[model samples]
Structures are given as C-alpha cells and as structure tokens.
Target: MAFVIHMPLTNTKAATRYAAELPMRETSPGHYEGYYTATSNVRATGATVEVRAQDDYGNTASEIAKGKLNIN
Candidate 1:
C-alpha cells in the first residue's frame, strides 16, 4: 500500500500524474506513513489527497479526498 499527497494548485487537476509524489513506508500491516518537505512553490487550501493501496496479489485500489486539504 502507498500514500501520496498532491499539491493543490488552483488550476491543477486533482489526479495529476506529473506532480511530486511521496514515497511511503509500511509501519505495520495495512498501515503506512509518508513525508514530504513543503516548498515555497506549492501551497493551497482545499487541496486533493490521493491514496493508492495494494495487496500482496498486486491488486490496487485508489481513493481521493478532493478539496479537503489545506497547505501553507
């Protein structure tokens, strides 16, 4: 499983494939954590957060929390 956060730009799409991606570490079974440095180039309110989870069988599921992020 993987967790990712997309920087919210007012004009950018929620699921941008070219945006900066965070690498996740599996702390425990079915648990994950990811960290990224905040840069002056990216900041917004009501941003988009995307999570992509996968199983041992390579089955992947993706979920998006749109317009629910606030970055400073």
Candidate 2:
C-alpha cells in the first residue's frame, strides 16, 4: 500500500494545521482524500500545496502543486 502526506505551509499565526505533515486517508485502493477547513484567509496566489507519497517498498515521491489559489 502507498501512503500520502501533505506538507503544511507556514503562516502568520506561528503555526496552523498546515504547519505539520498531514496524512491523507486512503479512501480506496490508490485513491486518497483529505479535507481541512482553512484557518485563515489566503490571497489569490498565496497558497502552496505539496504532496508526497511513499510505498511499502520504501519508494518515495513528492511534488509541489503549482497553481493559483482560488479564493471563492
């Protein structure tokens, strides 16, 4: 099985929920989902999301999602 991790982004509040490595639950095989309410407001381009994954075999992969923050 593979596990996913979300790296938290630093904020002005010293540390928010995004300040630690949050793990996403594997809803189904190979599918993971995570839900979190924003603790503070973010500008249209002020948010960054990083995703990482590791397999039971010790293989690891990571990526920083590149996109504008959609404040709607």
Which ten residues in a row are the worst by lDDT in model 2? Answer: 1-10
lDDT value, candidate 1, whole model: 0.66
User: Which lDDT value does model 1 have at 12?
Assistant: 48
Estimate, for each residue in 1-72, the C-alpha lDDT of model 1 and write its tens digit: 455665532334664555555667889986788775556666667767788877789998889855587776
In model 1, which range of ten residues has the least summed lDDT?
A: 8-17
After superposing candidate 1, which stretches have Cα over 4 Å from the reference?
A: 8-20
Off by over 4 Å in 2: 1-18, 40-44
Q: Which residue pairs show collisions in model 1?
A: none
Error of 2 at 35 (Å): 1.8
TM-score for all predictions? 0.63, 0.56
